[model samples]
Target chain A: MTATMPQAAVGASLSPAAVARIRADFPILQERPHGKPLIFLDSAASSQKPVQVIEAMDDYYRRYHANIHRGIYHISELATEAYEEARSAIARFIGSPCSAECIFVRNATEGINLVAYSWGRSNVRAGDVILLTEMEHHSNLVPWQMLAQEKGARLRFVPVTADGRLDMNRLDTLLDGARLFAFTAVSNTLGTINPVRELCLRARAAGAVSVVDACQAVPRMPVDVTQWQCDFAAFSSHKMLGPTGIGVLWGRKDLLDAMPPFLTGGGMINVVRYDRTTFADVPARFEAGTPAIAEAVGLGAAVAYLTAVGMERVARYEHELAALALEKLRGIGQVVVYGPGIEHRTGVISITVGDIHAHDLASILDREGICVRAGHHCNQPLMEKLGVPATTRASFYLYNTPDEIDALIAGLEKAKRIFKLT
Target chain B: MRPADDLSGMDELYRDFILDHYRNPRNAGTLEAPDASCEDLNPLCGDRIRMDVKLHDGIIEDIRFQGRGCAISQASASLLTETVKGKTVAEVAALGKDDVLANLGIPISAARLKCALLGLSVLKRALKL
Candidate 1:
């Protein structure tokens, strides 16, 4: 059944069945925590793996464990075939025109750096502008800052409204004489699902290349690179119930073929000598050194599992869960929810209690076996702009139930009672 | 909110003295004195502080600070101001690393030790020592 119904009802009816089935699918979620079932609400940071993804990796390692490519051995041939199969799976997931355009890296940060150091450094001339948003994680912002510094290009920010959504007019203003525009499709801290298609259309009109950081978005919603028509996109596997140390960067094949390699190493080369070396084709030119083979396989399995459940269902369920969380936290009255209330937010909810340190509140929650992240969330500039030292963030995923949201409410009540915040 | 009973060992770090200072910080705002000011940050961890020291007769007449950071860093700033307020420049310069470490009485991981010691590092940088 479609999970678009109100969350409280889902908890009472639909979620119990869903949870039973889903919990069985995820072995780790069944573990006891102080005699209580584990409540994982930090999926925005990293998601727990399902058996499908785990078994896929196990099957690869056990059956076809060998160095991929450059070997005529049977295991190597099998390993190479499996590795390329995973690449094709990822390209299909993201709707890339060709599997050759996808480059594998350590994580989303490295993917962004690849674009910044190579594409940005090469294309961006002095006095040209690179547009970004104040809401960006450092991964998307810092590399551009360094590129601007090195290339003598201007790094400009598209102003975010007081309510945390992007100001399209300000983005238009910032795009003047711009070489490229890079922004997050979903803010890690604010939980704003950016209008990426609209932004990309505008960026194209401005003659600026558009790069979407889909690290938070790809896992939560359907991301079709062909439909969005972004020049480049990056996302991490760990954030989507796959293993860490594997990330995907999908760019238009033409753009990727034209750009130079960010790293120089063994696997990414076509030919090398003492004097000069030639790089491989589009994707291999970017993928340097030994790649995370098992992790990529796991990510392929994750893609297959997500496809089975369907992304629209995941999105619908997450939206309901987030609204429930927002309603419950707002009911407390002392907590201030950041971002566009709860209605327009992604699965993340960042909050602060009146006169209580975010870190202290998080520590209190941790004592009750309810884990949440507290700090600037690696966005110090955003924290400064928001005029808060830190915030406590609770993020949800497909596996999270509305019962867990109630449990969170209970935990917060205990925290309030202990801290006398009420 | 205070830590749990199982976190008793952390009491040395989150002592009443430190928590009291954190809750009700002393000289927390910028100093209006004619002394020089220095702003420093541990960029790796995003810890920052601005120290305002008022000097008279080569001795610190008043020391105030203003900034945002974690408990360990902020509490250490409070303790540093208390220790160096009336001390001479030469004496403050002579302050040992052990003295700074003793003031922050917690077992700090190597990565976090640098974050905890940031205030002292800034103080030394200010002293040109």
Candidate 2:
């Protein structure tokens, strides 16, 4: 593996010369809604696709749209090779040890479920403990809850500090009896970037397997598995400038070899018999039936685009946007922003007004052609802990600029007036 | 867009009555003299409220609530407390969709109607009326 990059190294910031050219690469950003320029700040929900990713998928379907691995024909071979190439691309993107370690699933939800049903069902015993955080997306929390219920195992939580970052001191306490520590590299709702490397080191000392959900982190920052030293990590393509219906679950090779296949179907089996059947190797064993071939190709293209621009540049750009967003939101005295202290937090920011409901706020914002997500964001437990029904979140991405941040502030001001929040 | 009075879509749903109730909620505190009190939540959207009904001689003498949630929920609770203040358990049990609509002074979306009706429904179940 590449020499472990400095964990806190701030790489080369994007040159002013590069910003205009990079913006040109995404065609959809040129679109307008309500006769106003589009200001997309919901990338945490799903990222906008670049022209390269769109063209790559279109090229695949137009040229060689054939079922993979089973066909003897030329087009079939090409399709199979393209699909496998995507797996390799994803493997390299995350700095996984081997291409075979990358298993493509439906989404991060399904990827985590695979671990829960296959690995968790077999390994988690009645007295075991699964450590989760208070700020996980439902994808990471529910699976473990189900596992704990069925296996009679206990589900513990690492509490979030008042500033929204994970309280590692609490994590140290919870690590004592935990067999699995499922943590998110970034909080989707709070925008808090967790200290994953440090957390993983603690989990290792505690004799627990570490699983990092990088669905939000991979899009905003550079994620290197070798450096983070986690046993497993999962991320969705749609959240990271890639297509929907394609996600990657990267795990340690030895662990992958030990865990049983998650789904049972044709594509994953090596041999079949009436009495017994043999499953394929690490990845194929988990991928059941026909896979999301074109989506994977699009994701590969998305990774290529992010690489060309550089993840460090992406992180720097998003951090600047987050700071700008925070400053603007703080200026509105009526608005209360959650997750404020973490310096390395992602571009996402969740907020609520003094008395106005988030739904009312979101509806008013939508009228102005600004898109923001207003709900629990699939983190209901976190909402309960925060003592709020819901919060409106505006998550930024690579295409977002300072002007858009200004517009958001202006739109929010308008919302306050419309809702009589002022 | 239809005139603000038209209330064609969600605009009709966010009525002034609801906004008023949300702003100045009645029975906003806990009811300690309650025979039964059940806290319910719409776990999907995290709208939670505790209902307190002071039932005396099979009649709702007083009712109050104490919880935090969306405007729709808080407004609904306020309207419910107002509507069922002196009504019998049987009458409150008969409170249906139309009554809730009339109280809100506008129609609610299918998703939010549940939030508007959560307190009433749970109260009905608790009273067995």
Q: Write the per-residue lDDT of candidate 1 for residues A1-422, one digit (tens) a residue.
A: 33334543243222567756776899998687555667777788889999999999999999988888798999989888878888998899888879998888899999999999899878988999999999999999999999999989998998788998888877777888888999999999989989899999999999999999999999988889989979999999999989998999988888888999899898989999999999998788888887888888899899888887777777877877787787778789688888985555778988888755665566556545666887788888998999987888999988888888998888777656544455
Candidates, DockQ: 0.20, 0.30
Docking class of 2: acceptable
Residue runs of model 2 more than 4 Å from their true location after superposition:
A1-36, A340-342, A419-422, B1-17, B29-39, B50-67, B80-129
lDDT of 2 by residue, A1-422 (tens): 01222233245656556766777888977877665677778999999998899999999999999999989999999999989999998888888879998999998888899888988998899989999999999999999999999999999999988888888777788999899999999999999998899999999999999999999988888899999999989999999889999998988999999998888988999899999999999788998899999999999999999988889889977776787677668789789898845375778999998777787776666656678888899998898788777999999887877777888887777656545566
TM-score of every model versus the real structure: 0.87, 0.87
DockQ category of candidate 1: incorrect
Q: Tell me, what's the RMSD of every candidate?
A: 4.0, 5.0
